[model samples]
Structure formats: C-alpha cells, structure tokens
Target: MDESFVDGVQGKPGSGLIGNRKFVISKKNLAAQNERGGEENIATGWHAIEFLLWGQDLSETGPGDRSFEDFVDGKAPNADRRRQYLTVVTELLVDDLAGLVKAWAPATKGNYRARFEQGGKESVRKILVGLGSLSRGELAGERLEVALNSQDQEDEHSCFSDNTHRDAVNNAKGIENVWLGRYVRADGSTLQGASLRELVAAKDAALAERGTRQIAASVAAAEAIQAPFDREIVGAKDAPGRQRIQKTIASLTQQSKDLVAAANAVGITKLTLVQP
Candidate 1:
C-alpha cells in the first residue's frame, strides 16, 4: 500500500487512529477527518452544518477561518454565525430551484417572490450554480418583500388600519431639516462659527420681532379703517352709526385673538411689539 494512503488512514501516533472504523478516508473528501485529530476543524457549527446539509450559507459572513461548529460550540465569539448559516442555506436552496419553488409555493401563493421567483426553477438553479454558497443581502431584501406580502394576507384587517397610516405619517414628520447660513462681517467677510446655535437663536428672535411688527401693521390698518368711519358717524351724530363702530371694535378684537391662536399652533410665542 502507498505510504501516503496508509498515513492518510492511520495518522501519526499522537494524531489518533488513522484507519479505525470511526475514521473514513476517501479521495472524494476534501475536509480533514476529525477522528485523526489534526485540529478537528471542519467548520461545523450552524453555518458549516447548514452548508453540509444544504450546501450553502444564508448569512454573508464572507470567507474566514471560523467554522459552523465554532458557532454551535460558542468557540467563535467574533464570527457572525447567523450570516454564515444564511449564506449556505440560500446557496443550498438555489441548488434545487424547481423543488424549492414547488415546496414554497404554498407559502408564496402563486405571487412572484423575487427576480428568481419570476424565472422559476431555472433562475434559482442558475443563481445557485453561479454564486455557489453565498447569500446576497439585496436579493434577500427583495425576497423578504414577497414574504411580507404573503404574511399580510393572514392579517388583512390590520394591514391597512387607520392607526398604521397615522403611525407612518407621524414617523415621516419626525424628520427635521435645518440649514446653516454663513455669517458675514460688516466688511462682507464671513465669520467662523458665527452660525452656531446662539447666533441662530438671535436670528430667530429678530424674525419674531418682525412678526410682531406685522401685528402692529395689522392694528394700524384696522384703526385706519375704523377711524374714518368713526369720524363720519360722529359728525352725523347718528345712533345707528355708533352701533356699527362698536361692532367693528368687536370684530377687530376677534381677529387679534385668531392671530394669536395661529401663532401658538406653530410654536411661535413671546412676541414683543414696538409701541408707536
């Protein structure tokens, strides 16, 4: 018998039994035998196991020294075992594209789940052959959308509820955008750090002052209209005209109150109006 063949079965002394029943060596096997005890590193945790059985890893952990067994035994703390397992699982799934589709048809309910789903078994087989045992996250995301739609069928009523719509709107509104403009000096040069929060606050305060000035302008406009009518009615000394002035005063008061209410709704308070 060839020495290499004999040595392959009965590994060197401390390495453990080479040709024992527990140890099987064949030309087809690429991985080392565990019984021979040369590191026993077959990558056997969830990822390795998934790869061995399914021939793929679902998680995209990438090529590394860690094994599937390391994940199961908790020896590989740094490795992302979940990704590895998924990578292998996806790969294996791609192998029997037709079989997998038929098996998953009940869950998919005839709707296309992904690009692969559209192509059916042939597409899946091509993917498996091309990518081998790698799980593509982008493809997985697309696949998940199909799964989610199928799942939504089971809870149809809650799927399009008012609360869900409201939550989505509220979440969208939570995003805030703020712009910072450069502060310029008297000579037209920009100042460093001049657009900080304190400066912005001061600028906002100035805007509030301008808003109050608008209120003053509104009061002036109202008074201008009332003054001419008051003068006409006073000159005529008519009771009916005096009643009209009183109604006008009330209307102006209500308008002022409404303006205040509008300001409060937008979080704009503490206005200081300059008296004429």
Candidate 2:
C-alpha cells in the first residue's frame, strides 16, 4: 500500500514469489491503499515494502525464518505474480530517474575536459617562458664580457707610450675618466660626467705616487736580499729578535703599498707575481 515503495522498485527485475511467471504491482492500487490506512499503519506497510524490495526480512526473522522455507515449499503466493508486480512498478518510475542522470552527464564531462586542457596549456607556456629568459641571460653575460675586453684593448692602444708629459698625463686622465664613466653607468649613479672624470683623475694620480714609492722600496728589498747573512746578528735586549723581525716586516709592507699604487696609476687593478 506504500506508493513510494512501488515507485522505488518500478523498473527493477524481481525474484518470483507469487507464481512461476513474472508480474508487477499497480502504482494506483498502492497509492489508494496508502491513503486509506492510518498514518502509523501506513508507515509499517512502507517499512515492510522497503524490506521486501531490498531483499530484507519483513519481520525480525533470522536466516532460518520459516517464511523463507514456506516460500521455497511452494505454499506461499505465486512467485511469478510477485515478480511481475515489482517489475511494472519499477518500470513506471525509472524513466524520470534516468532522465535526471542524462541531463547532468554532458555538463560534468565538459567541465572536466576544459580544466584538463587549460592546465596543460599553462604548463607548456611556463616552460617556454623560463627557457626564453635563461637564453637571454646567457647572451647578456657574453655581451658584457666582450665589451669589457674591447674597452681594455682600446685603452692600451691609445694611452700607452706618449712622448710629451702633457700627452701622457692627459691620456692617463682620459683612461681614469673612462673607467669612472663605466662604473657610474653600471651602478646607475647620477654623477655628472665632467665631475666624475676629474675625481677619477685625482684618484689615479694619488695611486701613481704610491706606486712609485712601492717600486723604490722593492729595489731596496732586492738589494737586501742580495746581501750576505751574518753568523751572529746583534740586537737590543728584551725580545730584540722579535722587535727586529717586526721592523723588517713593516719596511716590506711599505714597499708592497708603493707597488700597489704604481699598478693603480696605469689602471692595472690586479697583479700576480710568479716567483722562481
């Protein structure tokens, strides 16, 4: 008598319980009986119908229930009649359910495919852009190295071996100005070109003076090296040997400073000495 129960099993195949042949329940009859029953009684019948449709026990019966025995013994309602009843009921409701499922399939499939394609395209674009940037960086580094080397060659050709003192001084100043210009441009600084050139020239002159002093000290060091060592060198008391070593080290240091200054005047920023 439960209409919803009939609706639930509307199109499902059934096991025969009423006869040897298949049968289906009437939806109108089920609905009419449900309307006539008391509310509590209708609920009980609905529960029983659900149990039967889902292959559950109608009562609190165990696996050894006599109802199952009686059903198998051919003493119950015809199996075919029960089966046909369930089948017809299911047939009536399944069309609406199937239509609902069909309506959702296209949208779900379309959205999934769209997302998959979008993700794939984005991944490819990211890889291409990264490779492009890396290529550009390598090209920029090579260009910078070539520019620095070219600048060095031009300085050597134009500024080396001038006869007049004025020409030599002007050329050294020009070289210093060029170095400063490059530095300021590289650093994105806002210094005026004229001022930068003057400042760089002054710095170069000071460095040159220091280099001359270092060269003089180096000549002294060479002479000291050639001198013969005494068997017993005399010194003042109270760690005189340590004091003498310290004074010698200081003289050698002054010579190093003068050498560094001389190198700077010629725009030689680095020096490597190979000792034999």
Candidate 3:
C-alpha cells in the first residue's frame, strides 16, 4: 500500500489524502468502523500498523515513538480503543496474508500458482513485468523521486518508522533474488537453483551478465543510503543524503531497463506493469 495517502475518515475538509495528518486515533473510531463492516479508507498493512504503534513522525531526525503507556488504561487517552484497534487491524492483516498464501499454494488446483506453474513463457513475461515495474515506476519514481522532488519529510516512504532506507535495500535485493532464483533463509542457509538468470544466460549470455551486474549495483547503492529517511529528503538538492538517494534511484532505473532487455532476449516482446 502507498504509505502517504490518508486511508480513512478525515477529521476536516480540504485536507489532501497525502497531506492529511488527522488520522482517526481514537479507538472508539475503530469500533464504529468495525460495526459498519470496516472502513474502505483505513490504510491497512504496514503503515497502518506502524501508525498505531508509533503515532507520528513529528521530528526530522527520528521516527514516531509513541509511549507504551499510550496502550495502557489511565495513562493515555482512549488506551482501550488503541489496543482494540491494533488487535483488529493485525488480525485482518494476517487474514489477508493467508488469502495470498492460499492463492499461491503450490498444490492448489486452479489457483494462481497452478496457472503460473504451467504458464511457461507467459509466466516468465510476468516475472519480468514485475521486476521492471517495481524497479522503475514503483521504487525509483513513485517512492524515491516523488519524495525527493517534493522535499517533504512526510512524503518519504515509511515515514512513521524511518525505515525507508531499509525498504530501498530490501526491495532491490528482492528483485535480485527473483532474477537469481536464490534465497538466503533465516537460518543462515542459502538456496540456489535454476532461475531466470540461467534461462537468460542460455539465450543471451552477455545480456544476462549485464542484468546481474546492474541488479547488484542497485542493491549496493540502496545499502549506502543512511537511515532516518525523513532527514535524508529534506536538505539541499545536492546534499550528500539526497545524492545517495538519487544514486539509488538511478541504479534502479538502469536495472529496470536491464530487466526489459533481458525479457526481450528471452523472446518476450512486451513487458508491462500491473495497472495502478
């Protein structure tokens, strides 16, 4: 989900979705929404949970740090409501993830995974589409460039947690992982197998190698970005932090182009992103 947009009820009019800071912080608001079969606008997933825990990022140097007392009765306003809201939102998030798991379950008949497994060239096309879309439009453009151009601290992705640096690193690595068909398990083990990299190599070795190098460069560039991302986006246009972000953006843009070239080398004619 987009982090900046206001997801639910606005306290006042004329407040833009991305600029609205008046989130419904009252727990009672959750109850009312739940009874109404849930709110269509309540931002769900990562940012929603982060807001419930951290409140807001009022500072440029650090993330929101809501006190634990905020969740305790007699310590803060609407403590009970906050706890209930967290519980409900977390449960809903889990349920939604479960649905995704079912859709991609390897053995499920007529599920997305089943179709994907048999899709062959079309499936490869889908993978390329995903990598290019995420690298180019989603990360480099929408997420990074948008915030940098606006120079608004609140415009940074994961602003509430100041985790946008990590977001950039992990997202770039994720694209690399898909390309290499490699995963480093939590137990410090590595899984390597035949992948898009190998397939592309068989068709066009130089293109495959170029894609690998570009993806690795992007990951390295992303890792160089400093944390407290809100701080990073607010300085002079040529500031060190902003330059680091710009380099990552440039690398991801190049990586996305490499993905398209890789796709073409493998006989896929067109690559397209999922419609927003």
Q: Which one wins on TM-score? A: 3
What TM-score does candidate 1 reach?
A: 0.17
Task: Note the residue pairs that clash in candidate 3.
Answer: 7-41
How would you encode candidate 1's per-residue C-alpha lDDT over 1-276 as one tens digit per residue? 011221111243112122233443332232333223333233222323322332221222221122455335354332233344344435543554766666566456554444445784354234222221111121112211222233322111112111222222222111100012234467988655322123323546554344344334333333333212212133332454344433333333333343343334334453332111
**Candidate 2 local lDDT, 104-123, one digit each (tens):** 45546555334444575343
Q: Model 3 misses residue 129 by how many Å?
A: 0.6
When superposed on Cα atoms, how far off is each prediction in RMSD? 31.1, 40.9, 5.3
**What is candidate 3's lDDT per residue for 1-276, written digit by digit as tens?**
322233221243223132333445333443343324333344456577887677667777889777898779998655665676577677777877898999998888999999999999999999999999999888898778989999887677787788889998999999999999999999989999779999999999999999999999999999999988877777787999899999999998888888888988889987876321
- TM-score between candidate 3 and the true structure: 0.85
The C-alpha TM-scores of every prediction are: 0.17, 0.21, 0.85
lDDT of 2: 0.34
Q: What would the TM-score be for candidate 2 when compared with the true structure?
A: 0.21
> Cα lDDT of all candidates, in order?
0.31, 0.34, 0.77
Q: Rank the candidates by lDDT, best first.
A: 3, 2, 1
Better of 1 and 2 by TM-score: 2
User: Is candidate 1 or 2 superior in lDDT?
Assistant: 2
